[model samples]
Target: MRQAMYGLVLYVFLMLPPVANLAESVMTIHMHMQMPLFVIAGMLMTPFLKQQFPRFFAKWNSNGVPGIILFMIVVIYWMIPRTMDEALTIQAIEIFKFISLPFLAGVPLRDSWKKIRLVGKNIIFVTLSVICGFMAWLYIFSPEQLCNNYLIVEQITLGWAFLFLALSIMIYFVQQFFVDRSECE
Candidate 1:
Protein backbone atom coordinates (compact mmCIF):
# COMPACT_ATOMS: atom_id res chain seq x y z
CA MET A 1 0.00 0.00 0.00
CA ARG A 2 2.80 2.40 0.82
CA GLN A 3 4.48 1.59 -2.47
CA ALA A 4 1.29 2.14 -4.36
CA MET A 5 0.74 5.48 -2.71
CA TYR A 6 4.30 6.48 -3.43
CA GLY A 7 3.95 5.54 -7.06
CA LEU A 8 0.76 7.56 -7.38
CA VAL A 9 2.35 10.60 -5.78
CA LEU A 10 5.40 10.29 -7.98
CA TYR A 11 3.30 9.96 -11.09
CA VAL A 12 1.34 13.10 -10.23
CA PHE A 13 4.42 15.14 -9.46
CA LEU A 14 6.06 14.06 -12.68
CA MET A 15 3.00 14.93 -14.67
CA LEU A 16 2.22 18.13 -12.83
CA PRO A 17 4.18 20.50 -15.04
CA PRO A 18 2.52 19.37 -18.24
CA VAL A 19 -0.91 19.33 -16.71
CA ALA A 20 -0.39 22.77 -15.23
CA ASN A 21 0.70 24.12 -18.56
CA LEU A 22 -2.35 22.60 -20.13
CA ALA A 23 -4.57 24.22 -17.54
CA GLU A 24 -2.85 27.55 -18.07
CA SER A 25 -3.28 27.37 -21.79
CA VAL A 26 -6.88 26.29 -21.51
CA MET A 27 -7.65 28.65 -18.65
CA THR A 28 -9.87 25.93 -17.28
CA ILE A 29 -9.88 25.72 -13.50
CA HIS A 30 -11.90 22.55 -13.75
CA MET A 31 -9.16 20.68 -15.55
CA HIS A 32 -6.57 21.62 -12.97
CA MET A 33 -8.91 20.70 -10.12
CA GLN A 34 -10.03 17.40 -11.61
CA MET A 35 -6.49 16.17 -12.22
CA PRO A 36 -5.48 16.29 -8.59
CA LEU A 37 -8.90 15.35 -7.29
CA PHE A 38 -9.02 12.25 -9.45
CA VAL A 39 -5.58 11.15 -8.31
CA ILE A 40 -6.23 11.79 -4.66
CA ALA A 41 -9.68 10.25 -4.73
CA GLY A 42 -8.37 7.10 -6.31
CA MET A 43 -5.52 6.87 -3.85
CA LEU A 44 -7.68 7.47 -0.80
CA MET A 45 -10.24 4.94 -1.92
CA THR A 46 -7.68 2.13 -2.04
CA PRO A 47 -7.38 1.39 1.66
CA PHE A 48 -11.09 1.70 2.23
CA LEU A 49 -11.71 -0.80 -0.54
CA LYS A 50 -9.11 -3.19 0.80
CA GLN A 51 -10.80 -3.12 4.16
CA GLN A 52 -14.26 -3.48 2.71
CA PHE A 53 -13.41 -6.29 0.36
CA PRO A 54 -10.54 -8.19 1.83
CA ARG A 55 -11.12 -11.36 -0.12
CA PHE A 56 -11.00 -9.53 -3.43
CA PHE A 57 -7.93 -7.49 -2.50
CA ALA A 58 -6.11 -10.62 -1.35
CA LYS A 59 -5.84 -11.98 -4.89
CA TRP A 60 -5.32 -8.83 -6.89
CA ASN A 61 -4.65 -9.69 -10.53
CA SER A 62 -3.21 -6.32 -11.56
CA ASN A 63 -5.64 -6.19 -14.45
CA GLY A 64 -7.91 -3.18 -14.25
CA VAL A 65 -11.13 -2.28 -16.05
CA PRO A 66 -10.96 1.49 -15.55
CA GLY A 67 -7.49 1.78 -17.04
CA ILE A 68 -8.54 -0.24 -20.04
CA ILE A 69 -11.66 1.84 -20.60
CA LEU A 70 -9.73 5.07 -20.19
CA PHE A 71 -7.18 3.95 -22.74
CA MET A 72 -9.80 2.89 -25.23
CA ILE A 73 -11.70 6.14 -24.80
CA VAL A 74 -8.60 8.19 -25.51
CA VAL A 75 -7.74 6.05 -28.50
CA ILE A 76 -11.21 6.18 -29.93
CA TYR A 77 -11.43 9.93 -29.45
CA TRP A 78 -8.09 10.40 -31.17
CA MET A 79 -9.17 8.28 -34.10
CA ILE A 80 -12.55 9.89 -34.59
CA PRO A 81 -11.88 13.54 -33.89
CA ARG A 82 -11.87 15.65 -37.04
CA THR A 83 -8.79 17.60 -36.05
CA MET A 84 -6.84 16.63 -32.97
CA ASP A 85 -4.54 19.28 -31.60
CA GLU A 86 -1.13 17.75 -31.12
CA ALA A 87 -0.53 19.05 -27.59
CA LEU A 88 -3.95 18.11 -26.24
CA THR A 89 -3.76 14.72 -27.89
CA ILE A 90 -0.37 14.08 -26.36
CA GLN A 91 -1.54 15.25 -22.94
CA ALA A 92 -4.58 13.00 -23.01
CA ILE A 93 -2.41 10.03 -23.98
CA GLU A 94 -0.08 10.69 -21.10
CA ILE A 95 -2.90 11.22 -18.64
CA PHE A 96 -4.50 7.96 -19.69
CA LYS A 97 -1.22 6.17 -19.03
CA PHE A 98 -0.93 7.68 -15.57
CA ILE A 99 -4.44 6.56 -14.61
CA SER A 100 -3.42 2.91 -14.67
CA LEU A 101 -2.78 2.62 -10.95
CA PRO A 102 -6.36 3.13 -9.79
CA PHE A 103 -7.70 0.82 -12.42
CA LEU A 104 -5.28 -1.93 -11.53
CA ALA A 105 -6.22 -1.62 -7.89
CA GLY A 106 -9.93 -1.49 -8.63
CA VAL A 107 -10.57 -4.42 -10.97
CA PRO A 108 -9.61 -7.45 -8.95
CA LEU A 109 -10.94 -5.96 -5.75
CA ARG A 110 -14.51 -6.17 -6.99
CA ASP A 111 -15.54 -9.53 -5.53
CA SER A 112 -19.21 -8.68 -5.16
CA TRP A 113 -21.85 -6.37 -6.57
CA LYS A 114 -22.36 -4.61 -3.28
CA LYS A 115 -18.72 -3.65 -3.08
CA ILE A 116 -18.78 -2.57 -6.71
CA ARG A 117 -21.73 -0.32 -6.06
CA LEU A 118 -19.94 1.17 -3.11
CA VAL A 119 -16.91 2.00 -5.22
CA GLY A 120 -19.07 3.44 -7.93
CA LYS A 121 -20.81 5.66 -5.42
CA ASN A 122 -17.49 6.86 -4.13
CA ILE A 123 -16.26 7.66 -7.60
CA ILE A 124 -19.41 9.58 -8.43
CA PHE A 125 -19.17 11.55 -5.26
CA VAL A 126 -15.53 12.37 -5.92
CA THR A 127 -16.15 13.44 -9.48
CA LEU A 128 -19.13 15.59 -8.59
CA SER A 129 -17.33 17.15 -5.66
CA VAL A 130 -14.38 18.04 -7.83
CA ILE A 131 -16.63 19.58 -10.43
CA CYS A 132 -18.37 21.66 -7.83
CA GLY A 133 -15.08 22.79 -6.37
CA PHE A 134 -13.87 23.80 -9.80
CA MET A 135 -16.98 25.82 -10.39
CA ALA A 136 -16.47 27.60 -7.13
CA TRP A 137 -12.84 28.26 -7.93
CA LEU A 138 -13.73 29.75 -11.25
CA TYR A 139 -16.38 31.99 -9.74
CA ILE A 140 -14.09 33.27 -7.04
CA PHE A 141 -10.65 33.36 -8.63
CA SER A 142 -11.08 34.10 -12.33
CA PRO A 143 -14.56 35.17 -13.12
CA GLU A 144 -13.47 37.23 -16.11
CA GLN A 145 -11.52 34.44 -17.74
CA LEU A 146 -14.51 32.18 -17.66
CA CYS A 147 -15.73 33.67 -20.91
CA ASN A 148 -12.39 33.81 -22.67
CA ASN A 149 -12.44 32.54 -26.23
CA TYR A 150 -8.80 31.52 -26.62
CA LEU A 151 -8.91 29.30 -23.55
CA ILE A 152 -9.33 25.78 -24.85
CA VAL A 153 -10.40 23.70 -21.89
CA GLU A 154 -9.66 20.05 -22.41
CA GLN A 155 -12.33 18.70 -20.15
CA ILE A 156 -13.85 15.28 -20.41
CA THR A 157 -16.44 16.02 -23.05
CA LEU A 158 -19.93 15.54 -21.66
CA GLY A 159 -20.73 12.48 -23.77
CA TRP A 160 -17.34 10.90 -23.22
CA ALA A 161 -17.43 11.39 -19.47
CA PHE A 162 -20.80 9.71 -19.22
CA LEU A 163 -19.62 6.85 -21.37
CA PHE A 164 -16.53 6.37 -19.26
CA LEU A 165 -18.59 6.28 -16.09
CA ALA A 166 -20.95 3.76 -17.64
CA LEU A 167 -18.09 1.57 -18.72
CA SER A 168 -16.72 1.52 -15.18
CA ILE A 169 -20.10 0.55 -13.79
CA MET A 170 -20.38 -2.24 -16.35
CA ILE A 171 -16.95 -3.54 -15.53
CA TYR A 172 -17.85 -3.70 -11.87
CA PHE A 173 -20.97 -5.63 -12.65
CA VAL A 174 -19.05 -8.07 -14.81
CA GLN A 175 -16.47 -8.61 -12.11
CA GLN A 176 -19.19 -9.28 -9.57
CA PHE A 177 -20.89 -11.78 -11.85
CA PHE A 178 -17.71 -13.70 -12.36
CA VAL A 179 -16.88 -13.73 -8.68
CA ASP A 180 -20.32 -14.99 -7.83
CA ARG A 181 -20.04 -17.88 -10.28
CA SER A 182 -16.63 -18.84 -8.98
CA GLU A 183 -17.79 -18.80 -5.39
CA CYS A 184 -20.55 -21.25 -6.22
CA GLU A 185 -17.86 -23.90 -6.61
Candidate 2:
Protein backbone atom coordinates (compact mmCIF):
# COMPACT_ATOMS: atom_id res chain seq x y z
CA MET A 1 0.00 0.00 0.00
CA ARG A 2 2.78 2.39 0.86
CA GLN A 3 4.58 1.47 -2.32
CA ALA A 4 1.44 1.97 -4.31
CA MET A 5 1.08 5.43 -2.87
CA TYR A 6 4.64 6.20 -3.80
CA GLY A 7 4.01 4.96 -7.30
CA LEU A 8 0.95 7.12 -7.53
CA VAL A 9 3.02 10.05 -6.39
CA LEU A 10 5.66 9.33 -8.98
CA TYR A 11 3.03 8.98 -11.68
CA VAL A 12 1.63 12.36 -10.79
CA PHE A 13 5.02 14.00 -10.51
CA LEU A 14 6.00 12.81 -13.96
CA MET A 15 2.77 14.12 -15.41
CA LEU A 16 3.40 17.65 -14.23
CA PRO A 17 3.77 19.97 -17.22
CA PRO A 18 7.15 21.42 -16.33
CA VAL A 19 8.61 18.06 -15.48
CA ALA A 20 7.17 16.44 -18.55
CA ASN A 21 8.39 19.20 -20.80
CA LEU A 22 11.89 19.13 -19.40
CA ALA A 23 12.13 15.39 -19.69
CA GLU A 24 10.80 15.45 -23.21
CA SER A 25 13.09 18.28 -24.23
CA VAL A 26 15.90 15.79 -24.74
CA MET A 27 15.19 12.85 -27.01
CA THR A 28 17.34 10.41 -25.08
CA ILE A 29 15.77 11.41 -21.78
CA HIS A 30 12.33 11.02 -23.24
CA MET A 31 12.94 7.55 -24.59
CA HIS A 32 15.33 6.12 -22.02
CA MET A 33 15.02 7.84 -18.66
CA GLN A 34 11.51 9.27 -18.40
CA MET A 35 9.82 6.32 -20.03
CA PRO A 36 11.57 3.73 -17.88
CA LEU A 37 10.62 5.63 -14.75
CA PHE A 38 6.99 5.35 -15.75
CA VAL A 39 7.40 1.61 -16.08
CA ILE A 40 9.08 1.44 -12.69
CA ALA A 41 6.23 3.33 -11.13
CA GLY A 42 3.81 0.81 -12.51
CA MET A 43 5.94 -2.04 -11.22
CA LEU A 44 5.93 -0.45 -7.80
CA MET A 45 2.14 -0.42 -7.82
CA THR A 46 1.74 -4.00 -9.03
CA PRO A 47 1.13 -5.37 -5.56
CA PHE A 48 -1.90 -3.18 -5.05
CA LEU A 49 -3.21 -3.82 -8.54
CA LYS A 50 -2.79 -7.55 -8.14
CA GLN A 51 -4.50 -7.51 -4.78
CA GLN A 52 -7.50 -5.76 -6.27
CA PHE A 53 -7.72 -7.79 -9.47
CA PRO A 54 -6.45 -11.19 -8.59
CA ARG A 55 -9.02 -13.03 -10.66
CA PHE A 56 -8.40 -10.85 -13.69
CA PHE A 57 -4.70 -11.57 -13.61
CA ALA A 58 -5.18 -15.27 -12.95
CA LYS A 59 -7.71 -15.70 -15.71
CA TRP A 60 -5.99 -13.58 -18.32
CA ASN A 61 -2.37 -14.37 -17.59
CA SER A 62 -2.40 -17.88 -16.25
CA ASN A 63 1.12 -18.80 -17.37
CA GLY A 64 2.44 -15.22 -17.46
CA VAL A 65 2.97 -15.56 -21.22
CA PRO A 66 0.01 -13.34 -22.00
CA GLY A 67 1.23 -10.66 -19.62
CA ILE A 68 4.72 -10.95 -21.01
CA ILE A 69 3.35 -10.61 -24.52
CA LEU A 70 1.46 -7.52 -23.52
CA PHE A 71 4.62 -6.13 -21.95
CA MET A 72 6.56 -6.80 -25.14
CA ILE A 73 3.92 -5.24 -27.33
CA VAL A 74 3.86 -2.09 -25.26
CA VAL A 75 7.64 -1.94 -25.20
CA ILE A 76 7.97 -2.49 -28.95
CA TYR A 77 5.36 0.11 -29.73
CA TRP A 78 7.24 2.71 -27.74
CA MET A 79 10.52 1.77 -29.35
CA ILE A 80 9.35 3.03 -32.71
CA PRO A 81 10.61 6.58 -33.31
CA ARG A 82 7.39 7.58 -35.09
CA THR A 83 5.37 6.43 -32.12
CA MET A 84 7.35 8.73 -29.85
CA ASP A 85 6.70 11.62 -32.18
CA GLU A 86 3.04 10.77 -32.30
CA ALA A 87 2.93 10.64 -28.53
CA LEU A 88 4.38 14.12 -28.38
CA THR A 89 2.14 15.64 -31.04
CA ILE A 90 -1.06 13.83 -30.22
CA GLN A 91 -2.69 14.16 -26.83
CA ALA A 92 -4.38 10.79 -27.03
CA ILE A 93 -1.14 9.00 -27.82
CA GLU A 94 0.60 10.74 -24.96
CA ILE A 95 -2.17 9.64 -22.64
CA PHE A 96 -1.81 6.13 -23.96
CA LYS A 97 1.93 6.26 -23.30
CA PHE A 98 1.32 7.05 -19.65
CA ILE A 99 -1.40 4.46 -19.26
CA SER A 100 0.22 1.71 -21.27
CA LEU A 101 3.73 2.02 -19.89
CA PRO A 102 2.62 1.67 -16.28
CA PHE A 103 -0.43 -0.57 -16.49
CA LEU A 104 0.31 -2.67 -19.55
CA ALA A 105 4.09 -2.85 -19.49
CA GLY A 106 5.26 -2.27 -15.93
CA VAL A 107 2.56 -4.12 -13.99
CA PRO A 108 2.68 -7.15 -16.23
CA LEU A 109 6.48 -7.29 -16.08
CA ARG A 110 6.48 -7.42 -12.32
CA ASP A 111 3.68 -9.97 -12.22
CA SER A 112 5.15 -12.18 -14.96
CA TRP A 113 8.78 -12.16 -13.88
CA LYS A 114 8.31 -14.63 -11.05
CA LYS A 115 5.90 -16.87 -12.92
CA ILE A 116 8.10 -17.24 -16.00
CA ARG A 117 10.76 -19.93 -16.27
CA LEU A 118 14.42 -19.22 -16.94
CA VAL A 119 14.10 -20.16 -20.61
CA GLY A 120 11.30 -17.67 -21.13
CA LYS A 121 13.31 -14.99 -19.38
CA ASN A 122 16.28 -15.76 -21.57
CA ILE A 123 14.18 -15.48 -24.72
CA ILE A 124 12.78 -12.14 -23.66
CA PHE A 125 16.21 -10.74 -22.88
CA VAL A 126 17.67 -11.97 -26.14
CA THR A 127 14.78 -10.68 -28.20
CA LEU A 128 14.93 -7.27 -26.58
CA SER A 129 18.70 -7.11 -26.93
CA VAL A 130 18.54 -7.95 -30.60
CA ILE A 131 15.83 -5.39 -31.17
CA CYS A 132 17.85 -2.77 -29.34
CA GLY A 133 20.90 -3.58 -31.39
CA PHE A 134 18.97 -3.25 -34.61
CA MET A 135 17.49 0.02 -33.52
CA ALA A 136 20.96 1.28 -32.64
CA TRP A 137 22.26 0.40 -36.06
CA LEU A 138 19.28 2.00 -37.78
CA TYR A 139 19.59 5.20 -35.80
CA ILE A 140 23.34 5.47 -36.22
CA PHE A 141 23.52 4.73 -39.92
CA SER A 142 20.38 6.30 -41.32
CA PRO A 143 21.16 9.34 -43.42
CA GLU A 144 18.02 11.23 -42.44
CA GLN A 145 16.62 12.01 -39.02
CA LEU A 146 14.01 9.49 -37.88
CA CYS A 147 12.26 11.73 -35.39
CA ASN A 148 10.95 15.16 -36.38
CA ASN A 149 11.26 16.60 -32.87
CA TYR A 150 14.92 15.69 -32.38
CA LEU A 151 18.05 16.45 -34.34
CA ILE A 152 20.26 13.97 -36.19
CA VAL A 153 22.88 14.37 -33.51
CA GLU A 154 20.34 13.44 -30.83
CA GLN A 155 19.35 10.45 -32.92
CA ILE A 156 22.97 9.34 -33.11
CA THR A 157 23.41 9.87 -29.41
CA LEU A 158 20.32 7.82 -28.71
CA GLY A 159 21.64 5.18 -31.08
CA TRP A 160 24.88 5.00 -29.12
CA ALA A 161 22.88 4.76 -25.94
CA PHE A 162 20.86 1.91 -27.37
CA LEU A 163 24.07 0.21 -28.47
CA PHE A 164 25.36 0.46 -24.92
CA LEU A 165 22.06 -0.91 -23.67
CA ALA A 166 22.32 -3.88 -26.01
CA LEU A 167 25.84 -4.55 -24.87
CA SER A 168 24.81 -4.34 -21.23
CA ILE A 169 21.94 -6.78 -21.67
CA MET A 170 24.23 -9.19 -23.51
CA ILE A 171 26.81 -8.91 -20.75
CA TYR A 172 24.15 -9.67 -18.15
CA PHE A 173 22.93 -12.66 -20.17
CA VAL A 174 26.44 -14.05 -20.41
CA GLN A 175 27.16 -13.41 -16.73
CA GLN A 176 24.03 -15.36 -15.78
CA PHE A 177 25.58 -18.50 -17.28
CA PHE A 178 28.49 -18.22 -14.87
CA VAL A 179 26.56 -17.31 -11.72
CA ASP A 180 24.38 -19.85 -9.98
CA ARG A 181 21.36 -17.88 -8.87
CA SER A 182 20.05 -20.84 -6.89
CA GLU A 183 23.16 -20.79 -4.76
CA CYS A 184 22.73 -17.09 -4.05
CA GLU A 185 19.15 -17.67 -3.05
Candidate 3:
Protein backbone atom coordinates (compact mmCIF):
# COMPACT_ATOMS: atom_id res chain seq x y z
CA MET A 1 0.00 0.00 0.00
CA ARG A 2 2.69 2.47 0.96
CA GLN A 3 4.75 1.57 -2.10
CA ALA A 4 1.77 1.98 -4.35
CA MET A 5 1.13 5.42 -2.86
CA TYR A 6 4.75 6.29 -3.50
CA GLY A 7 4.42 5.10 -7.07
CA LEU A 8 1.31 7.24 -7.48
CA VAL A 9 3.19 10.23 -6.11
CA LEU A 10 6.05 9.59 -8.51
CA TYR A 11 3.62 9.34 -11.39
CA VAL A 12 2.04 12.64 -10.38
CA PHE A 13 5.39 14.38 -10.01
CA LEU A 14 6.57 13.17 -13.38
CA MET A 15 3.34 14.35 -14.94
CA LEU A 16 3.79 17.87 -13.62
CA PRO A 17 4.39 20.30 -16.46
CA PRO A 18 7.69 21.74 -15.32
CA VAL A 19 9.34 18.39 -14.66
CA ALA A 20 7.82 16.80 -17.73
CA ASN A 21 8.92 19.71 -19.87
CA LEU A 22 12.44 19.58 -18.54
CA ALA A 23 12.77 15.85 -19.16
CA GLU A 24 11.20 16.07 -22.61
CA SER A 25 13.46 18.96 -23.55
CA VAL A 26 16.40 16.57 -23.87
CA MET A 27 16.22 13.68 -26.31
CA THR A 28 18.21 11.29 -24.13
CA ILE A 29 16.39 12.27 -20.98
CA HIS A 30 13.03 11.91 -22.63
CA MET A 31 13.70 8.39 -23.89
CA HIS A 32 15.94 7.02 -21.14
CA MET A 33 14.81 8.76 -18.00
CA GLN A 34 11.22 9.96 -18.31
CA MET A 35 10.06 6.86 -20.18
CA PRO A 36 11.73 4.43 -17.77
CA LEU A 37 10.47 6.34 -14.78
CA PHE A 38 6.96 5.44 -15.85
CA VAL A 39 8.01 1.78 -15.99
CA ILE A 40 9.67 2.06 -12.60
CA ALA A 41 6.57 3.60 -11.09
CA GLY A 42 4.57 0.73 -12.45
CA MET A 43 7.20 -1.65 -11.09
CA LEU A 44 6.76 -0.11 -7.68
CA MET A 45 3.01 -0.56 -7.94
CA THR A 46 3.19 -4.23 -8.99
CA PRO A 47 2.51 -5.75 -5.60
CA PHE A 48 -0.77 -3.96 -5.31
CA LEU A 49 -1.74 -4.75 -8.85
CA LYS A 50 -0.82 -8.39 -8.44
CA GLN A 51 -2.87 -8.60 -5.32
CA GLN A 52 -5.82 -7.03 -7.02
CA PHE A 53 -5.76 -9.18 -10.14
CA PRO A 54 -4.23 -12.51 -9.21
CA ARG A 55 -6.26 -14.60 -11.57
CA PHE A 56 -5.62 -12.42 -14.55
CA PHE A 57 -1.88 -12.89 -14.39
CA ALA A 58 -2.16 -16.60 -13.71
CA LYS A 59 -4.38 -17.02 -16.72
CA TRP A 60 -2.54 -14.79 -19.17
CA ASN A 61 1.10 -14.68 -18.05
CA SER A 62 1.54 -17.96 -16.21
CA ASN A 63 5.14 -18.52 -17.26
CA GLY A 64 6.11 -14.83 -17.40
CA VAL A 65 7.61 -14.95 -20.94
CA PRO A 66 4.48 -13.48 -22.46
CA GLY A 67 4.49 -10.61 -20.01
CA ILE A 68 8.18 -9.92 -20.57
CA ILE A 69 7.64 -10.09 -24.33
CA LEU A 70 4.84 -7.58 -24.03
CA PHE A 71 7.02 -5.32 -21.94
CA MET A 72 9.83 -5.59 -24.48
CA ILE A 73 7.45 -4.74 -27.32
CA VAL A 74 6.23 -1.63 -25.54
CA VAL A 75 9.79 -0.54 -24.81
CA ILE A 76 10.94 -1.19 -28.36
CA TYR A 77 7.97 0.74 -29.73
CA TRP A 78 8.82 3.79 -27.62
CA MET A 79 12.44 3.64 -28.76
CA ILE A 80 11.36 4.51 -32.29
CA PRO A 81 12.03 8.17 -33.13
CA ARG A 82 8.59 8.57 -34.68
CA THR A 83 6.90 7.23 -31.56
CA MET A 84 8.78 9.74 -29.43
CA ASP A 85 7.68 12.52 -31.75
CA GLU A 86 4.10 11.33 -31.59
CA ALA A 87 4.27 11.33 -27.81
CA LEU A 88 5.21 14.97 -27.89
CA THR A 89 2.61 15.97 -30.48
CA ILE A 90 -0.38 13.70 -30.09
CA GLN A 91 -2.28 13.83 -26.81
CA ALA A 92 -3.61 10.32 -27.30
CA ILE A 93 -0.18 8.85 -27.89
CA GLU A 94 1.21 10.76 -24.94
CA ILE A 95 -1.52 9.36 -22.74
CA PHE A 96 -0.77 5.90 -24.06
CA LYS A 97 2.87 6.37 -23.24
CA PHE A 98 1.96 7.16 -19.68
CA ILE A 99 -0.49 4.28 -19.24
CA SER A 100 1.29 1.61 -21.24
CA LEU A 101 4.79 2.03 -19.87
CA PRO A 102 3.74 1.41 -16.31
CA PHE A 103 0.74 -0.90 -16.48
CA LEU A 104 1.44 -2.86 -19.63
CA ALA A 105 5.23 -2.98 -19.42
CA GLY A 106 6.33 -2.39 -15.88
CA VAL A 107 3.86 -4.46 -13.93
CA PRO A 108 4.11 -7.43 -16.20
CA LEU A 109 7.88 -7.27 -16.32
CA ARG A 110 8.19 -7.39 -12.57
CA ASP A 111 5.88 -10.36 -12.35
CA SER A 112 7.55 -12.13 -15.23
CA TRP A 113 11.17 -11.53 -14.28
CA LYS A 114 11.02 -13.96 -11.37
CA LYS A 115 9.77 -16.70 -13.63
CA ILE A 116 12.45 -16.28 -16.28
CA ARG A 117 15.57 -18.45 -16.25
CA LEU A 118 19.12 -17.07 -16.23
CA VAL A 119 19.53 -17.77 -19.96
CA GLY A 120 16.30 -15.97 -20.74
CA LYS A 121 17.37 -12.98 -18.70
CA ASN A 122 20.70 -12.86 -20.50
CA ILE A 123 18.92 -13.07 -23.83
CA ILE A 124 16.84 -10.05 -22.90
CA PHE A 125 19.94 -8.11 -21.86
CA VAL A 126 21.69 -9.00 -25.11
CA THR A 127 18.70 -7.90 -27.14
CA LEU A 128 18.57 -4.58 -25.31
CA SER A 129 22.28 -4.05 -25.87
CA VAL A 130 21.84 -4.65 -29.59
CA ILE A 131 18.97 -2.22 -29.66
CA CYS A 132 21.04 0.42 -27.94
CA GLY A 133 23.93 -0.12 -30.31
CA PHE A 134 21.67 0.05 -33.35
CA MET A 135 19.99 3.20 -32.13
CA ALA A 136 23.34 4.76 -31.35
CA TRP A 137 24.65 4.06 -34.82
CA LEU A 138 21.54 5.43 -36.46
CA TYR A 139 21.51 8.58 -34.37
CA ILE A 140 25.22 9.35 -34.70
CA PHE A 141 25.43 8.72 -38.43
CA SER A 142 22.13 10.15 -39.66
CA PRO A 143 22.50 13.59 -41.20
CA GLU A 144 18.85 14.54 -40.74
CA GLN A 145 16.94 14.89 -37.52
CA LEU A 146 15.03 11.71 -36.75
CA CYS A 147 12.75 13.38 -34.27
CA ASN A 148 11.33 16.74 -35.24
CA ASN A 149 11.14 18.00 -31.64
CA TYR A 150 14.87 17.59 -31.18
CA LEU A 151 17.83 19.10 -33.01
CA ILE A 152 20.40 17.00 -34.87
CA VAL A 153 22.89 17.71 -32.11
CA GLU A 154 20.46 16.38 -29.56
CA GLN A 155 20.06 13.27 -31.65
CA ILE A 156 23.82 12.79 -31.65
CA THR A 157 23.89 13.19 -27.91
CA LEU A 158 21.20 10.54 -27.64
CA GLY A 159 23.30 8.35 -29.87
CA TRP A 160 26.25 8.73 -27.55
CA ALA A 161 24.02 7.93 -24.62
CA PHE A 162 22.87 4.75 -26.35
CA LEU A 163 26.45 3.75 -27.12
CA PHE A 164 27.39 4.26 -23.51
CA LEU A 165 24.47 2.14 -22.38
CA ALA A 166 25.37 -0.68 -24.74
CA LEU A 167 28.95 -0.67 -23.67
CA SER A 168 27.98 -0.68 -20.01
CA ILE A 169 25.73 -3.69 -20.52
CA MET A 170 28.43 -5.58 -22.34
CA ILE A 171 30.95 -4.78 -19.62
CA TYR A 172 28.61 -5.95 -16.90
CA PHE A 173 27.88 -9.22 -18.68
CA VAL A 174 31.55 -9.90 -19.33
CA GLN A 175 32.37 -9.27 -15.71
CA GLN A 176 29.56 -11.57 -14.63
CA PHE A 177 30.74 -14.30 -16.95
CA PHE A 178 34.27 -14.10 -15.63
CA VAL A 179 33.10 -14.17 -12.01
CA ASP A 180 30.85 -17.16 -12.64
CA ARG A 181 33.65 -19.09 -14.35
CA SER A 182 36.07 -18.32 -11.50
CA GLU A 183 33.54 -19.52 -8.96
CA CYS A 184 33.23 -22.86 -10.73
CA GLU A 185 37.00 -23.44 -10.68
Which candidate has the top score in TM-score?
A: 2
Candidate 3 ranges beyond 4 A from true positions:
180-185
| Weakest lDDT window of 10 consecutive positions for candidate 3 | 176-185
Q: Model 2 reaches what TM-score against the true structure?
A: 0.98
Return whichever of 1 and 3 wins on TM-score. Answer: 3
Superior candidate under lDDT, 2 versus 3: 2
Superior candidate under lDDT, 1 versus 2 = 2
**Tens-digit lDDT string for candidate 2 (18-50):** 999999999999999999999999999999999
lDDT of 2: 0.95
Can you write out model 3's per-residue Cα lDDT over 1-185, one digit (the tens) per residue?
Answer: 99999998998899898998899999999988999899999999999988999999899999989999999999999989999999999999998998999999999899999988889889988998999999999999999989989999999999999999999988887777768666766
Candidate 2: clashing pairs of residues: none
Whole-structure CA lDDT of model 1 = 0.44
lDDT of each: 0.44, 0.95, 0.92
Candidate 1, superposed: residue stretches over 4 Å from native:
1-5, 8-15, 23-158, 181-185
lDDT of 1 by residue, 61-158 (tens): 23344433443344334322221233344666545534542343232233222333456545644554444444444334442433332332333332
Residue 68 Cα positional deviation in candidate 1, in Å, after optimal superposition: 24
* Candidate 1: residue pairs that collide: none
